[model samples]
Target: AQPRRWPLEKHEYKRYGRQLIMPEVGLHGQLRLKNARVLIVGVGGLGCPAAAYLAGAGVGTLGLMDGDTVEESNLHRQIAHSTARVDMNKTQSAMEYLQSLNPHVNYNRHEFHLTPQKAIQIFEQYDLVLDCTDHPTSRYLISDACILTGKTLVSASALKTEGQLIVLNNPPRPPGDALGGPCYRCIFPKPPPAESVLSCGEGGILGPVVGVMGVLQALEAIKVLTARAQRPANGGDWSTNGATSEAAPKATLLMFSTYNTPQFRSVRLRSRRADCAACSAQSTISRQSLTSGSLDYVAFCGATAPINLL
Candidate 1:
């Protein structure tokens, strides 16, 4: 049985009229969004737009986690920060804008870098997590932490004119079934060499590319949160019939190349790996591992950062 949903207020119904009219997202879906608790781990590029849309959609609890301060150069892509807020922590700046967009959302600010020491603790507070950080170390950390905590993860990456989106480790539709999708480790067991990793600041990015990916991140999160209890544990393809069919909602990887003739391609992904160190039957990443700080995600990812959470 699905849990009871809170009723929408008269003002809320009026506010979200356009969305409420959609057959896929009527009153029930909107209520699910309103009750969701989402944590955004970076307030730049991807996080800004994702947080903005989630707030506007009335996600009940929105958490902003980032340690960096806003810089003048970030104005183009980080829409949540303003000229007046330059040099302020990104979390604070984003929160200022988000609250203005929807005061109904309960905002939590984590004005610190997402270190492994705090990743699991903070992730436990949210039903879903968005990985918008650019650092290789941070990405691996977020991925591992989400798998460890069993939180649904919507992770996206944008570089130049290219963007990628995937939903990972969502809970199975039926309560005790195997994991619904692959964890980040199943796809990228090791991060790229540090020398080859270039952030948006270093390599430059088309604003619209990241914007598009960020918006899709929010859309995926909404779908996962509102989906029926019997929805497939795996990913599905987008069909003319939409995701109503049984085979419509399986795990798929989206690759967006703005330069290509057909810019978007969705490839169905395989099931979880039995040998995955994080989410497998004999997984090494456990609560004990986390508590002992035994995992070396930074080193495993070939990152050169000094992220010694242990």
Candidate 2:
């Protein structure tokens, strides 16, 4: 006789007994977390902590994508890597650490930059995307890909002593809804003049600051995936219940300054411009038309412009 098929066992609730006790995240929430899949696009300062926490929290599957290798300088902030993995790929190092944290959680790693062609293909496989990249170009590219694919994007950014986090679900617009909330492009219609901005290499960052921001990023991802109850009437166009009524869903821009006096402030995002180069057909179509030739995003991001040399 053939051996009897064994019944699938339920998740080890005892392992997450404390989380189960929380009113916000009880048994049901834990189950939801176990079923969710999240994609983190970078394994640097921000991604390291966010990915660590999410994996520890029992996210069903964690996807880590990064093309860089660990460096001696990165050890100060990127807590996921160690001196032993100094020259290893960021994704591999992150995966090894996450696996050790929670062996039950499924971990996937991609040692490649998030190119346009790879964005849609990879994003389609996951339920949510986390923009943990440091550069503005990668953030915008991920945002555009999320919009086109209709995926929830939990976007965050950290530099120096501050950071910002936002959830963009691409809520459905009502018929003839002319007042659309900003996309990433609405806030930054174009990449800033390359010379105007400095990288983390030029401007130093605090290790702990990135840690706090990354934790918040992971928290937001959990809230979004578990469908947590929202706070009452914050007076924002975006619905607290994650619903899109007649009003356009708002985009929030938060700033943090940690050098002199630590502070967090929310900046109002302007309405979307119909003529935005990134959103407008004039810009996207022209770029998409270059199928026969290669497109250099670094140049498109203005990083390779003449002014960037200065």
Candidate achieving the largest lDDT: 1
Residue-level error in angstroms, candidate 2, position 97: 1.0
Compose the digit string of candidate 2's lDDT tens values, residues 208-284.
88777788789878876766445324434654474545555566666666764547777766554566544433435
TM per model?
Answer: 0.88, 0.81
* Residue 225, model 1: Cα distance from true site in angstroms: 1.3
Error of 2 at 279 (Å): 6.0
TM-score of 1: 0.88
Kindly report which residue pairs in candidate 1 clash with one another. 234-250, 234-251, 235-249, 235-250, 235-251, 236-249, 236-250
Give the per-residue lDDT of model 1 (tens digit) for 1-310.
9664648888898888888887667888898888899999888889999999999888899999888899999898899999999999999999999889899999999988876667778888999999988876776678778877778889999999999998988653221225456777777777788788887878999988999999999888888887866554353445544344333134579999999979999888866766777777766676666656676666777767664321
What is the model-wide C-alpha lDDT for candidate 2?
A: 0.72
Clashes (N, CA, C under 3 Å) per candidate:
7, 0
